[model samples]
Structure formats: structure tokens, C-alpha cells
Target: MLRTTLVAAMLLATTPAFAQPEPARVEVNGMHMYYEVSGEGPPLIVLHGAYMNIETMGAIIPALAESHTVYALELQGHGRTTDIDRPITYQNLADDVAGFMEAVGIGKASVFGYSMGANAGLQMVIRHPEKVDRAVLASVAYDAKGWQPEFLAFLPQLAPEFFVGTPVEDEYRRLAANPEGFPALVDKLIALEHEPLAWEADVAKIETPILIVQGDADTPSPEHAVAMLRLLGGGTMGDMGAPLPASRLAILPGTSHTALMNQPELLKALIGPFLRGETPKGMFD
Candidate 1:
């Protein structure tokens, strides 16, 4: 998937404005997984947030593709991937991601996920460490308590109509393999959100370099974001002559979880180099 710089540019030239690379399907975990492959260089699997699909990451992919082979997957029940009768959980989705990577013959790659996708990204590192070299978790927390009470309280009250005027509803209607399944997907997610999260120990055990990004005013307060980072070896002063921690944290100013995709440039600045095996400019330093 490593392409010369000129080749990367050519791919862009051929891609129309606001369109992603054409998607390909694979069988993973008994589901027909849909993924879009683009860009050139090391592989980077980009996971979209719950209730969204590849298009959610559309604004960010073109730039990211300039330097990496981007594998954007639509998880089970989201986008073109069909849902099963099983309960929706990050652990199951993480397994599907692992199977998808294997199906596509990608042995190892950096993974990035936002919001619910962020939850999955962290799980990928914990559940399938061999397949991920680094991970980026944005707008999420590893524990249920990591979320603000207001946000937690509002989960069960969400209805599909609540997103009617937004792109979330529009896209779900547009790209979901089973358009009618959107409502079901929403309910499942609401239920999942209320369940206790158990990622602190898993995250603490992850040795893969990670970048934790969040919007200052987004889900889980900045304080909780820092707490998660601490568990992942970030947000701490280093001992004299000690090795620098592999994890980094960033809190985007004036950002919201729902608004993350719009600020592609800032996200690219914070994460681009880190995926390339380079130290990202420390946002917290």
C-alpha cells in the first residue's frame, strides 16, 4: 500500500470532490463488512462513531490518505454493514475489526476512532494488541463515569427524530445497508451507553503508543479525559532521564463530540505525525 508521493496525488486527482474511495466488501465475523481503501503508505484503519459511517470521517480521510493507506470500515449495524441479533458492544465490534483486518491481509496498522469509535479503538488495542501499533481515541472515555452526568442522562431519551435536521439522520438514511435499521441501531446504542464501561484496566495494560484527543467541552469533562490519559501513560511529568511515554493527549479548543469531523485540519496536525512513527508535537507539554 506504500505509494510514492506522486502516486498519492494522482489518486486524489481522480477522486471527485466529497467522494471517498470506492468501497469493497469482505466477510468478517459472519458479517459482510464494508470498507473503503485509499491513500498510500502504512495502513491506518479509521473507525467512525456510532450512528455514523465512513462519510462521517470523509473530511479527514483525504488529508490522512496523503500519507497512509486508509482503511475505513463500517462496523456491524452501521453504514453498509448489516446488524445481527446479538447485543451491540465494543468488544464484539473490536472483534469484527480484528477479523476484518485479517480478512484484508493487513497484519498491523495504526487505528483511529472518534466517540463510540474511540471506545472501539481503545478496545482494539486491548483485545487485539498484535494487530495495532498505535491508536488514537478521540471524544471518548474508558469508563462509564468518564461521561458527564448530563450526557448520560440524555442517552435513553434520544429518538431518531431528534437527529432529523442533522447529517447523522441524513447519512444513516443514505448509506445504511438496511435503511430501516437505523432506529434499531439507535436504541441499541442508547442501551449500550447506559451499561457500565470496563476499559480502565484494559487501557492501562496497552503498550501501544496512543493519542487521546477530545474537545474541551465534549463528552466526559476535560478532567475525565485527563484521568483516562493517566491510565494510558499520558498526562504525567517524566522522571529525570526517564524515557518519554508513548501516549499523548490533546483537547481541542471549543470542540464538541458531534463537531469533531468539521475540524479536520486541527486533528490532522495533532495526529498525522504520530501515525508516521514520529512524536506528535505535545499538546499538553
Candidate 2:
């Protein structure tokens, strides 16, 4: 059961409610990155998880597009973007996103990132704070220890062949500029999984308002999520009269990493108000 669930979580694919619009290309960090923009309002950058593209973000794109101009990106070798020689790391991906925004004329925007994208968004918040307003980080872990032990144990066994008949492979073959490089991409991502990822110290220094969204059964353990909230100055007793923390945490019941992406309605409800800076008024308030 753990292996099966981990496989699905690694793929992170979801059926799109609608076909993606034509993507535009921009020269970013020595690669021609692909991105699509939709709807209108405040600028919001939406990033996909590992082995995922803009289409795999599922209904969340449309859900967010209704309230914000959604800039859905294909990072590095994923989706329509071709492989570059540099290793796939959170820092590199974050740098590419920052450069992409600069090349495309967006000065600053809110970011909503999931899984691998979430890690990159954390880097952006830490390494390039001036370019982000607010951020929504979904299914992320600050360090290797934050991952559930079972999930961490399963990472070493990952191989491209395991995904051959899955939607992940199908989409890669359909959209990757260099389709035959899928195996190489998987290898790079595998190395990425093994890379050191301790960022709790950096996270403690972040000043940008962020929402940490996790599934009850996510790869990052629930306790780790709460620890992250504390690092972000969250986990406060709001009704006790103290000021609310700049960050917030949401754990969806009965959801896994993959399942979390499918909960577009719930995500929209949490994300819209966060980005708009709308605080809900309660009777106690």
C-alpha cells in the first residue's frame, strides 16, 4: 500500500478539466521555459509538482484564474521545457522562476506551489524575497527529516520504468520538447530526492505571509507541518486576543499529496482570501 501510494504521489498527475491554452516561451536561465497565462486580476504564479506540468495542476488553475491572473509554469525539463545541463535543485528552479518573471515583465506576484514547486517557492521566499508578495506552499517539507519515513525509504527504488504506463509518462511523451529524455529527467529527479534539504533555519527568517497547506496523509508528516507553522509564527490561539500570525496552516482531512491537488474548491477557498488579504470575521472577533 505504501509503494502504491508513493508511486501515485511521485507521479502527481491529475486529469485536467480543460485543455491548456497555448503556452508562451521565455528565455530563462539558459533554458526556454514554457508558461501559460489565464483569467484576470492580481498576478499569481502557479507551479506544478515533480513530474507534473501546467495541465496536471488540474482544476486548481481554473479555480485560481477566476480570482487572479494565473501564470502556470513548466519548470526546467518538465512539460514543454527541454532538459538543461544543470542539476535539478530547488535553488535552480527558484532562480529560473525569478528570471522568468523578470523576463516576462512581472515585477512581483503571489506564488502557489505544490510539492517540488513548493520547495522552490520556499527558496524564492528565502533567496528572493523582494519578488514575492504572498505564497501558498502545498505538501512541502523543510528538510529530509520532515518526510514520513516510509516515503523517504521508498525514494531510492524510483525508476522511470515504474511510470511507463502511467499518466506521467503519457504527458511527458506528449509535451516534453525532448521526449526521449524522460529517463534522464527521472534520474535527475531521483538525485534531487537524495539531495540535502534542510531549510528550517532559513524558513524561520522569512517575513512574507504564507499559507502552508498539507494533507493529513501527506509525505510531510503532520507534526512536521505544525513545526513549520511554529517557525512561521503561526499555531496561535486566535480567540485569546493575541494577534494572528502572518502565516497559517491547513491540513485537509483524508487527503494525500496527489489527492490534495484535486481539491480545487477547498484550495480556492483558502487561497483566494489569503492572497486578497481578506480576514474572516468571527463572532469572537
Candidate 3:
């Protein structure tokens, strides 16, 4: 028995420290939320995109965990926090995030959100301004409607056979298998057809330091980015000498919509320092 115990101890000691299990689930506004907390320092909350979970930010979590305490959450109806009954809207999602932080006893935290997650971050900053110290919205658009055109355009490019054979098909099959809940799930996606968050007014109210990161190659068009920059009151343009703020735009060269996952160096360089309160080198040139 002593030898067995010794072996167990050895295995535990050899395990990578960063591979620790995620924290226990906690109730947030009557919903069970799964979250992982790590590192020690100022708190940073990461919100993942639609149809994704906390693990979607897996690429940068290790780097972020090195200096800041990272809180990664699985949003309602996604990942492990399934069976959500609430109507899906940016505000509802934001409230869920705020409630999650409150349940965890964190009064304020810096927020980093990607894609649909960025919309939630914006809503959080708007509704719970006091709870957000700083915010980073990566690969976001000024209008929620901006997603419709691209999705419609891309859907045709992907063969129906591809959708049928892909792993995502399994998720679709699973949802369809649920006779009782499948209708509601379909309704939710239908509601998302008309994204409710419009930027013209909300952009004016944001007072927190905002970082907008986009890849020149990833964005289907420059119009959305241009609109976002204009609404943010502009910043020092990068090598272009344009009026856009250097702080507002981190345009990665030759990257696509999912650049954050593919370009670690660029993401680390842009996000690491912004989170540390240091300006990235050459950001304003």
C-alpha cells in the first residue's frame, strides 16, 4: 500500500502544473456555469464566440495564465452550460457574464472577447461599466447585421456534402435528435438571423480603453472596420498614415478571420502588452 501511494504521488508531481483541472461549477443567476481559473494577479475574464466554448481561446490562455489570473467561462447554451431557456441576445448574454463574475466574488475584471464574444464584451462594458477595467474586442464589427452577408456568401461556397460529412454535422444531428428541445434551438438560431446590436449609439457611450484587433486578410471587407474606427473617434493610423487610432486597430498582415488561432506571435504581441497596460511597439507609426 505504501508503494502504491508513493507511485501515485510521483505521477501527480510529474503532471504538468498548467494541466490542472478547471474549477468547480457555480450558480450564476440560476444558471450553472463552468469556469476555469488560473494564475495570480489582476483578473481577466475571457468570453468565447457563438457556437464555441472557453476552449476556443485555448491558443492564448497559457500565455495569459502566465501573468494574469485568467477566468474562462462557457457561455449559456454553449459548451457545458447547456439547456439554456433564456432568449439569446447580446444583453442577456452580457447579464449572464456579469452574474458569473458576481457569483465568483470578482467586482471588476479586464475583459477579452473574440467574435460573438466581442459583442458580449461590448454589452458588458456598456451595462456594467464599473465592472470592466479595460476591454479588447478582437475581430468584431460595428453592426451585428454585418455577419449576415458573409455567412450567406460563405454558405454557398461550402458544399452541402461538406456540411453533411463534417464534424459539425454531429452537433447538428445531436440537436435534431432532441425532439423536445430541437424546436427551441432552431428558433434561437432564427432569432440570431437579425442581430440586434447596432453600433451607432453604443460606440459613443464606451468610455473604457478599447482595443480592436483585426486581420487585414481575415476581414472580408474594410467597410466594417472603417465604421468601427470612425465611431471610436479615430486613432493614430499605422504605417498607412490614416486617421484611425493605432490603439484601436491591430491589423495582422496576411491573416484570416480565425487569425487569432493561427497567428500566436501576432496575438501575443498585440494582446499581451495591452493587458499589461503597455503600448505595443510601433503601434502608432
Best candidate, TM-score: 2
TM-score of each: 0.86, 0.93, 0.77
Instruction: Tell me, by lDDT, which candidate is best.
Output: 2
lDDT per residue as tens, model 3, 96-189: 9899888889999999887667778888888999999888887776565444365545433433243233333343334232324434543564
lDDT against true structure, model 3? 0.63
Each candidate structure's count of clashing pairs: 0, 0, 3
Instruction: Give candidate 3 misplaced runs (Cα > 4 Å).
Output: 1-18, 145-149, 152-166, 169-186, 236-247, 280-285
lDDT of 1 by residue, 117-204 (tens): 8888888888899999899888767877777777766666655465444555556778777777767876677667666786777778
RMSD of every prediction: 7.5, 2.5, 10.2
Candidate 2 clashes between residue pairs 3 or more apart in a chain or in different chains: none
Greater-TM-score candidate between 1 and 2 = 2
Residue 256 CA error for candidate 1 (Å)?
1.7
The C-alpha stretches of model 1 lying farther than 4 A from their native spots are 1-20, 159-169, 280-285
Put down candidate 2 lDDT per residue, 196-235, tens digits, no spaces: 9899899999999999999999889999999999999999
Q: What's the TM for model 3?
A: 0.77
TM-score of candidate 2 versus the correct structure, residues matched by position: 0.93
Number of the candidate with higher TM-score, 1 or 3: 1
User: How does each model score on lDDT?
Assistant: 0.75, 0.85, 0.63
